[model samples]
Target: MNIKIGNNNKISSSTIANTVNGNMEFPKKSWYEKHPIIGGIIVSVIAGVILIFSFWADIVKFIEGVL
Candidate 1:
C-alpha cells in the first residue's frame, strides 16, 4: 500500500503501526506464520506419530520375529 503523504513522499503500509496509550501496536505474527514450513513439519510429525501408534503392535511383532 503506497500512501501519498505529500507531493513526493510515499509511505508504505508495512511501515505503519498503530499507536495506543503511548505504546506502539505492531502486528503480531504467529510462529507458524513466520516459518510457513513449520506447518508442514508439524503436520508430518503428527502423521508420523499417528502411524507409529497405529502400527505399534505390528512393529513389535516384527521386531520380536527378527530377534
Candidate 2:
C-alpha cells in the first residue's frame, strides 16, 4: 500500500481514487457508419498500396517496359 520514493518520501495507494469511470461505455460503430463510399475508397487505396509493395518488382518492370 505504501510506495517509497527517493529521500524518504512515502505515498499511500489507498488515498488515490480511480480516475477512470467504470460506467463509461464506448459507442460501437460499423465500418460504413461515417460514409460507405469514402470508407471503401480509403480501404481500396490502402489495399492497392499493400499489393503494390507485395509485387513492387513486377510493377517496376511493367512500368519500365511501357516507358
Candidate 3:
C-alpha cells in the first residue's frame, strides 16, 4: 500500500483515483475484450444465493433441533 516517491516526484489525480479504487475505469468493451471469462460474475451470484438460503431462519432452526 506504500507508494514510493523519489526527489523528482509528480502526482496526478488519475493515479490517486486508481490507487484508491484498485482498478482503473476502463471502457466495458475494452475490459471484456481483454478478459472474456465473465462467468465468474454468475458463479459469484449463485454462491451468494446459496449462502443466504443455507443461513435462512427455518433451515437454522431445523438443524438446531436435529443437533
Candidate 4:
C-alpha cells in the first residue's frame, strides 16, 4: 500500500506499522516483570511527581490572585 504524508512531515504508514508491530504483538509486562514491589514503588513515585506538578500550577494561580 502506498502511504503519503500530507505535509511531508509525517512518516509513511509502512514505517509506523513496522516500528509498532513488535510492540503490539506482546502485552506490556515490564511494569511488573522484574520486581512487583519495585515496579509499584516506581509507579507510585512517578504518579506523586505528576500530582505535585499538576497542583503546582493551581497553587501558582492562587498565589497570583492573592498577591
Candidate 5:
C-alpha cells in the first residue's frame, strides 16, 4: 500500500511500519507424559506388583500347606 505525501510525492506502508512473527511447532507429548499423577499412579502399581512377585516364597509356602 502507498500513502500520498503531497502532489507527486508518496510513501509506502512497509517503509512507515514493520512487523515480525515466529511460527513454531513443538513436539507432541504422550497421554501419560501430559498427566503426571496418572503416570505416577501406574508406575506405583507396577512397582507394587514387582514387590509381591519378589516375595513369592511366602505365597508358595502358604499355598502348599493349604493344598
Candidate 6:
C-alpha cells in the first residue's frame, strides 16, 4: 500500500492510518455504538467461524465421545 500524503505533501499518522485503499480503515468506536447489535452479531459470527475451523478435530472428537 502506498503512504498517504497530506495537502502539505507531508505524511501524517492519521493519513497513514486512514489510507484511501480502505485496508487500514477498521470499524471505529462510533460505528460500534451506532450499530451495537449488528456489530455484536458480526463479531460473534467471526469468532464462531474461527473457533470451528481451528478446533475441528477436537470438536469432532468431543461429539464422538458424547455419542
lDDT of each: 0.81, 0.81, 0.69, 0.76, 0.80, 0.79
Look at candidate 6 and give me any clashing residue pairs.
none
TM-scores for all candidates: the values are 0.36, 0.34, 0.32, 0.34, 0.45, 0.38
Tens digits of per-residue lDDT for model 2, 1-67: 9877645785555545668667988798887886889999999999888877757888889999999
In candidate 2 the C-alpha lDDT for residue 21 amounts to: 66
Ranking by TM-score: 5, 6, 1, 4, 2, 3
The sequence of per-residue lDDT tens digits that candidate 3 reaches over residues 1-67 is 8666654465444344333556778656675566667766767889888888745888889999999
Ranking by lDDT: 1, 2, 5, 6, 4, 3
Weakest 10 consecutive residues, lDDT, candidate 3? 10-19
Off by over 4 Å in 3: 1-37, 53-55
Q: Please give the clash total of every predicted structure, in order.
A: 0, 0, 0, 0, 0, 0
Question: What is candidate 2's CA lDDT for residue 19?
Answer: 80
As for lDDT, the candidate ahead, 1 or 4, is 1
Which candidate tops TM-score? Answer: 5
**Better model by lDDT: candidate 2 vs candidate 3:** 2
lDDT score, residue 9, model 2?
83
Summarize candidate 6's per-residue lDDT along 2-62 as a digit string, tens digits.
6556776675555334445546766666878989999999999998888877578888899
lDDT of 4: 0.76
Tens digits of lDDT, candidate 5, 7-62: 66744453544655577778999998799999999999998888877468888889
Full-model lDDT, candidate 2: 0.81
Off by over 4 Å in 5: 1-18, 54-67
Superposed model 1: Cα runs more than 4 Å off: 1-26, 55-67
Candidate 4: count the clashes: 0
Which candidate do you rate higher for lDDT, 1 or 3?
1
After the best TM-score superposition of candidate 3, give how far the Cα of residue 4 lies from its true spot, in angstroms: 57
**Model 6 Cα displacement at 55 (Å)?**
4.4
